[model samples]
Target chain A: MSTATLNVTTVKADFPLLGREVNGHPIVYLDSGATSQKPRQVLDALDRYYEEINANIHRGAYLIAEKATTAVEDSRAALAGFVGASAAEEIVFTKNATESINLVAHSWGRTNLSEGDVILLTTLEHHANIVPWQQLAAERGVVIRWIPLDDDGRLDLTDLDQLLDGVRLVAVSAASNVLGTLPPVRRIADAAHAVGALCLVDASQWVPHYPTNVADWDCDFMVFTGHKMCGPTGIGLLWGRRHLLDAMPPFMGGGSMIQNVTFEGFTPADVPTRFEAGTQPIAEIVGLRAAVDYLNAIGMEAIRQHELDLTAYAMRTLTERFGDDLAIHGPHDLENRGGTLSLAYRGIHPHDLSQVLDQHGICVRAGHHCAKPLMKVLGVNATARASLYLYNDESDVDALADGLAAAGDFFAF
Target chain B: MAGLEDLYREVILDHYRSPRNRGELETPPAIMAEGFNPLCGDEIQVYLLVEDGVIAEIRIGGQGCSISQSSASMMSAAVLGRTPDGAREVLRSFKEMMSIHEHGLDGEPISTDDQPGASGLGDLEALRGVVKFPVRIKCATLGWNTLDQVLDQTGT
Candidate 1:
């Protein structure tokens, strides 16, 4: 393994769930791509929020309300810094990444898109990224275009110019949840800008494992979730360019989002507040801030480097153990991929494989992973995916290998 | 480990390796129904040729995991020549076996009788172990559920 600056063993010790046993074996969690295990820091932050400062934010005159409001805004500022946004006002909090994407689709898409306009997307998107556009296209009579994938699972951008001809917006993923392929978002964003179209990135899988600078990416909008970054669920972020957010209409209309109360007409508040409708998830935001602090303490570069080393080690180990019996999907080069590994093995079904692996206390995902279009392109109905994160180590990879060997032996003719 | 062995029995593997009734039936007299387990991307299409209230022929198609495919294979073998009401009874019996009911074999003794139509489930008892694995219970029942839908649509 490569020399990581952060100590993974110490990091793993912070997560209480990792210490538990499943069935009779120690639990080896390799499913962080679905949702990461939370550290004690985040859990404690959430607990502290409920215990010490619990109140409705933004409207109350009580001291606790002021503290809650400050804490929530502080979290927004920290998350903005995490993704390199210029100001906290640019970060709009929503229920989750899925809701963030839907907010943009309802607010910006309905306003900007017209009949015959095109929304270009990539095949690597999750269902959250695909369904909203499909719904919008069906509603507005807009045409949707796709950027295809190469044989190795990276985006085939050779036909990108042709696809961008009438495109009004280009929405794509920064990383593939199934294939682990990291597309060049900067280039795609630049291409979209050259053609006078906007660019939106689904960074749900990217920000957790790597350092994300939305300004450096030069995209019009970006989104990510808190749960995938070792925080609590029910809180996610949508970071958009200041001008674009100011120009769009409010996503939800409610008490906190309005500037005036009248039956005749009402003016919406400023960008971020206009997007947040009801009472916010205050405890989740506090947990997210703590998660950001935890990740920052370890350093994003160190996490990325450590995952790269683990990915290489995993690929080498699995290939040595299974050889041609295993078919791994994604870019062959480690530099072009993340730590997610989706595998098809020995004609053993992914569900059966997952069941067998469960006997050994190994947690892996089995199925389309909400990327059915990519699964169709890969020519498989489903794949077993084992994704890695900061706390995962070489021993986890060994356990996975042992589990797969057992599955092979059990299913052998 | 014994749970795993019970789940992937030799008979289940045999059917998965060499599935029976795995093609299409001519459509003039055949009714088709498709089932999908969206959670796992397992898709199965069941085609039935019914004549005079009896299933004349049955075919299973599509792709999925061993449990789903093998279950479909075994289902076609069990229901091919039975009448629509008989097929419905068989479906109910199979679902009862897969469900968490108190009257299930969990509290009762295991039986070794292989007599046809003696135990109400016949070879379908091979899939009894699926109930233990809650997540995979859907995979094991995709075909039978589709067959139920098709038979319902065909007015039985």
Candidate 2:
């Protein structure tokens, strides 16, 4: 990408929601790991789409309907290209990453996994990824194993060889939402493949924060939510190998996913469509495509670098200011982590801290972050989390530090 | 930065840091109640020592946000020696106050002189400020919810 086109400040300004104020102060939205703010381009694309062409794709023959169909399929190819998937057929649309994981668990897992088969996951997985497998295992008598984490929250990869002995599928997060640790996905993928096991990468936290190529990672399936990547909420992508997607049974039965239905039986549509049942999230998919384009324009490399720098800045600011009173969970090294820090204030609870931060117009998450097993491993009920995205700069870090200090004083007094 | 004074009233902070009657009761037939805030994963466990329809003692243990912990502390301090009926009345008044931001407890002993003022839930009054901060409302009421469960279990 050309530096002439890369106007970082202008790009920041394009995000209209980021301009809003909270609690009589300019909102310092550091919770992008949860959901990112959309840019004008993405929002406008949705507006232009609805105004010009609004119709169900594939079946419609009218001009506007054809345009809508083209737009949807074009976005699909764009998204597939973005992930470096072998074909557009590999990309299936779902409501969010959770639905994507559930689709796989219900469809592929139900068919393949049986009694005595082992499914391996990590403690750092979101409830969405963990629960589906747990529910499946319970029904099929399959065993679930978790990869433990070290003190700094990096997954303990030392026991991978032993753990993979009977593992049928390895479902792991590319990055932890709570801890910010970016696991070695490629290595994990290689190990899983060696054992003839399918690998599913939950890249919900990693996709927006870093540049990812599914082909390079070589995972059997990859899932990420659009909302987390500065797109609309209802759309997410599940990229699977075409061969694997073709082999798996359909997840849900409804419109668009069927070729034809007869009294005798029904034949399912091809790969991608077979997994996506019902009316797709049309506007959201369009917005997601715009989001992907926006990021591509910015160059994900620059974004990743900027975030790494911000993470280092945040970690330094937090530790130096609070000392031992603050404990930052996750990998101590910034290189192995995403731009997230879940910290516990020694005396004050995360809820109190978040309340105080909210008053300051500093938005941060305070809780288990939907990773309760990780919380249990960390030995804390909850932690105050400040997650960063592209819009976050050094000033946000300063505000967070100031807020944490204020929380300490208020509670200590 | 907005000072914590806006949210953490001095009384509430005091209760949180040094909670009164924050522990467990003897294991024999204690009325146990648990409350959880699924949003934040905050949890509280409360045990009541009930004898002859009066709270002989009240003990609470568990981990949660400050509002819940302090509220639990204040709740324990308020209802320890009261009759189950009195405690239930106070609970009703407190719930009313939290939901509406004020209480007009009609014709109860709570309205009498020498009793605390409108927000004057006594130590429970420390949480009156919680109504303003909506998210903390769950934290403040977690203990009271547990207390409600305990009340239900004992059929009082």
Candidate 3:
């Protein structure tokens, strides 16, 4: 309901990399699904942390150490508030979203899951969400079932009762990185709860685009990364329900994640601290806080509105231009999707299409996009994906269309 | 655009359009090797029929981008009459041609045991332009790599 619209020009200018040229033309990056380009504000925040507050956190009596610890805690709290978590202590920092899921699969999966227990996943999950569970299933004799997709790429939950029967955990992605289908997470969570199952939301795609509320979704666990949302790399956030997180064992053992150590045995720390081992990524965490502040100032609802509107415009433009020749995969309903568009044009090989686009300085990811299973489901080897973020506008989409037209001419029989 | 043209020459395009020897032979009579480029999920399979120490027949399979598919076509045509050792020699020369820098053997541009037509690799020379676009170098070499693997399996 927020009427605050983003000024595309101003937002575009804030990203330093968007101004640079590639191959004698202005760069038009549409690969935010892979990783978003950081804005100047987020970039400056990293520099400021290194210059002013560079110190190892959590174990220092010195002034800079205290400051760094405070910064790290503040980032945790900010991220918690951003996602509507009850307490900052529930958020554990890890290397990336993949590591976050692995942390849960290794720690929580080992303790909670037994042989013959079922972990239900979706066909739309990225390999990060899928592989960890597979590893868990391999180690423990857990049977995995998939919630299949409909013809239009949305999750078909007609048999939810049967699918959730005796399921211990339901791990699903909030959005499909390839198809851009926003799965009905809240409904799925409710169904999962009805079956006495734990629900873990892989929000690596959804958190960056939409307004996220863990309590509203009623998910037991959620995980996402920083780099996709304008923060620096080497940092990811994992939020778990307080009781579950407290009960779960530590994932990695090292210098700092312990309360006490003995020759015989060792005692680990509590909650988030128990999970964060070794020297933490203080600067990147600080950068993440700055990124949250930036998004908060703009407001996530407004950002969502901008992207949704842009996605609609793009669909219309591309369809109008190419008609039957171009195919944009995913749901026809714009209300239930994000700004990611996986394009297939006139049967051009994705690699060829990607190469042609690069010459025009239009960067689109041309591969299986770490979702090889999804690729098989789509019945294509690969796709050229043009994903939009807060900074992208109609001009970027126009440039993509023009580039595709040029590719058509180049590959003409 | 000029760089793209160099990467996708007319011969490369023709080979992609109507690929030569695009199939497989029986298992006992032929050896098959498959290659996959993890970067783009494109795959290729090369089947070789060795008779009298020479490749009596060659066929290509799978699908990929222009560079990968066309390179396979050109490779199938090139190694038709050559011995397994001769095919390996051609692979070395083809890889050398596709390398961005002259990856000489111990500070030398050419290896000590060199073939006569290493520089002039016939139809395979169209792939030399792939060096300009470094990423597509993998695509161009997918066929040669598969053939090399199949030959290694054959042990001939």
Return the top candidate by DockQ. 1
TM-score of each: 0.96, 0.94, 0.96
RMSD of 3: 2.8
Query: Per the 3 Å backbone cut-off, how many clashing residue pairs does candidate 1 have?
Result: 0
**Can you give the DockQ of every candidate in the order shown?**
0.68, 0.51, 0.60
10 residues in a row with least lDDT, candidate 1 chain A: A1-10
Write model 2 residue lDDT over A27-135, tens digit each, in one string.
8898887889999999999999999998988878899989988899999998998888878888999999999999899988999999999999998999989999999
lDDT of 1 by residue, A270-389 (tens): 889999998989999999999999999889989998999899999999999999999899998987899999999898889989998999999999999999988899898999999999
Docking tier of model 2: it is: medium
- Chain B superposition TM-score per model: 0.86, 0.84, 0.86
| DockQ of predicted model 3 | 0.60
Residue pairs in candidate 3 whose N, alpha carbon or C atoms collide under 3 angstroms: none
Candidate 2's residue-wise lDDT over B29-142, tens digit each?
Answer: 787888889889988889998888789988899998778888889898889889888888888878877776433223223333343466457666656656666667788888
